[model samples]
Target: MALMTTDTRYTKVAIALHWAIAALILCNLALGFFMEGFEQPLRGFVIQTHISSGITVLLLSIVRIVWRLTHRPPPFAPGTRGWEKGLAHLVHFLLYVAMVLMPLSGWALISANPPPPPPGQIEAAPAPVPGGAAPAAAAPKARRGGPTKLWWVIPWPKIGPIQRMGTTPQGIAEQKLLHDTLVERHMQIAWIIIALLVLHVGGALKHQFVDGQAEFARMGIGRGRRAPR
Candidate 1:
């Protein structure tokens, strides 16, 4: 039997990381869904924000994993079934995998096909010649992959191998194929994360409301009830 104590709650750092990552993931999901509807500079800004948020989630997830490995989580509320515990563990594991993979896949996607210049970087077409004929428009610059700024501030490098795929015909074709595959995979992983999140939240609610367990409290919501002895 386990002794009842407040010590059963997760560590403060774990709780902070959990909420931070959750918030970022939700925001990024929204951005991904609606980014296309935006026009021009706004669209570019939204996409960059999405990437920055994803990278932030990835970094925080790594920290959270390390914290989890070192610190023991509170035991399940008394009377919790073995199957419930197993399912919870499985969902958590998948969430972690999805969290890591989603950002990495996004990085790879961008690397394979570098994004166009942001609105600020694009040069305006020269005014038409005052007298007779319009000046010929300058040719658009070819996109050579480069570092992205996190939140338009910190520099985040592209995946070298993926970004360095040459400009040759063959290399371009391979890069395009890889980009398409990664785009599909990224969406697939997102759906998986959504499913896992549903399960996780539903399970917690079931335990807290139906079973009268201090589920949220264990994750630092409210005061935790004593663990069953």
Candidate 2:
């Protein structure tokens, strides 16, 4: 791997976090779509994974933002255009917005819905049957949405009264409405993020190949060539 000189490249930590978050976002996007066809157990598992990955992206983004504030990005490659630079900055700003909003919206949506039981706790036993040998299973209830345990291991703290609002008919109906509205917003923003990513990557590749700039290298991806001053 050819590394750019420190003067012309991102710090290793920034590069690492950049790629890691990119991979996680891409993976979660795919999983979100993929879960549509899955059945109960598998769907539940995939949704949990998507939520966990998204939350991880949110946390990493926070750290990356801090790193960015303290550290200057590598200087632009030689001959980069004013319009191109403006567009790049715009895309980056939108990306940060999406990164911050996507996960928060998802978490909020989950919080607004009914929460699931804390990790590792067995669901309450079904009420006893009136006269049969086997106890009747409680009627399957609609998922109002709720606190999601991360990686099926770490418990996210219960967030709001919304989680506790599902016990009554009116509350359940209200929670479901909130859940649907949030899901729509979350998905719309996710798509916008993906579109911004396409533009961001397309611009970088254009610079790398069409413009003969070592743009990839500036992000620690490939070999760098020094431009004459």
Candidate 3:
């Protein structure tokens, strides 16, 4: 419905995307770290499911950004001084950039990977990656965060590259190294993004509960117009 702020507040869509993405990203971060612990993992099963989920999230995020560009959001409360406003904008900008980049990097990293089916792991006929993924039960809303959370996955554009490698270990090492580097970059950016999100969300909550302001509402419901005093 209404997307613009009439009285300096967030619209419903913006609020929903903000919180939903935040939760998703946070979960992804936790999972990415957890995945690292699994020394060797299997595919065509649980891992496949997980990767598929990631790709879905990534597509939605891209959609969210396009939505953001088309729609104008509500503003911070009047009491939001210069520094607070600046910080909020900065945090949001960084978040958006990281969100997009995280997945793209993963996709590229996946692309760079040299595909040699792992030892003892048998290769199955390649699945068609509509957008660089398997033709699956459901599209990947998979977030790549467990290890990378570029969470920008519908599982993502990784498997196709592997398919191209065609079980050749010839170029696999270089691809693996490239993939590792992309993964590392994804992790580093994620930490920064997480910290910023924490600060942003924490500050918003503080303003809402402690400072007794309607900052959160600005992003939750469409901004309400006020009567002249």
Candidate 4:
């Protein structure tokens, strides 16, 4: 195979998207684990941020995948070990798959749960008029049935009919089961992604320092080139 030249580097757009997605994923993972520690309003706020960030990841991942399909990345440098190259390819593929699935599972889980009631202003009861009776209390507005909004701003579409299932007693039990199942799956996949990241980062460090390959530059960050591995 022809060795990719040292001059080859990812486009600036690809590099920007790559780092941005990485940052978002790390933040989302942290938020997922810690959001429950907060009280209601703050917890709600963090959850909103987490969901928004996850949606952003999904959107960026799609664009990244399209860009990658259309523009080939530079090949492994000269004398790269077969095992290292193979492992790198496998990790990269899995990361892409996780990026797509993580947010989707999250959205599904959110849809399974009911949307919170909108914040309402408190009103004083009207004073009794000179003669007769008190006014009837106003009925609450119906909850909008759909996917949870991103950051409580952009509306996201629901995945399954899970929201509807929550209405009945029997359905509530089923919804709880489904919601828990999806949460387990999402957390499991998250750990897989984290494990893959450790391997990926370790490999880069090995290539950069131990092998003196400057391999990290392929993603457009580190200095390019060194003695051949």
Specify the highest-TM-score model's number.
Answer: 1
TM-score of 4: 0.78
RMSD of each: 9.2, 7.8, 9.6, 10.8
lDDT of 1 by residue, 177-199 (tens): 67778999999999999999999
Write down the lDDT of every candidate, Cα atoms only: 0.78, 0.77, 0.59, 0.75
| Regions more than 4 Å wrong, model 4 | 1-7, 114-147, 167-169, 225-229
How should the candidates be ordered by lDDT, best one leading?
1, 2, 4, 3
Give lDDT tens digits, candidate 4, residues 17-131. 8999999999999999998799988986898799899999999999999888877787777878999899999999999999999998987787775433346834222233334
Most accurate candidate by lDDT: 1
Which residues of candidate 2, in runs, are more than 4 Å off? 1-5, 115-140, 144-147, 164-169, 225-229
Q: For candidate 4, what's the RMSD? A: 10.8
Candidate 3 at 74: error in angstroms? 1.1
TM-score of each: 0.82, 0.81, 0.67, 0.78
Any residue pairs clashing in model 1, and if so which?
none
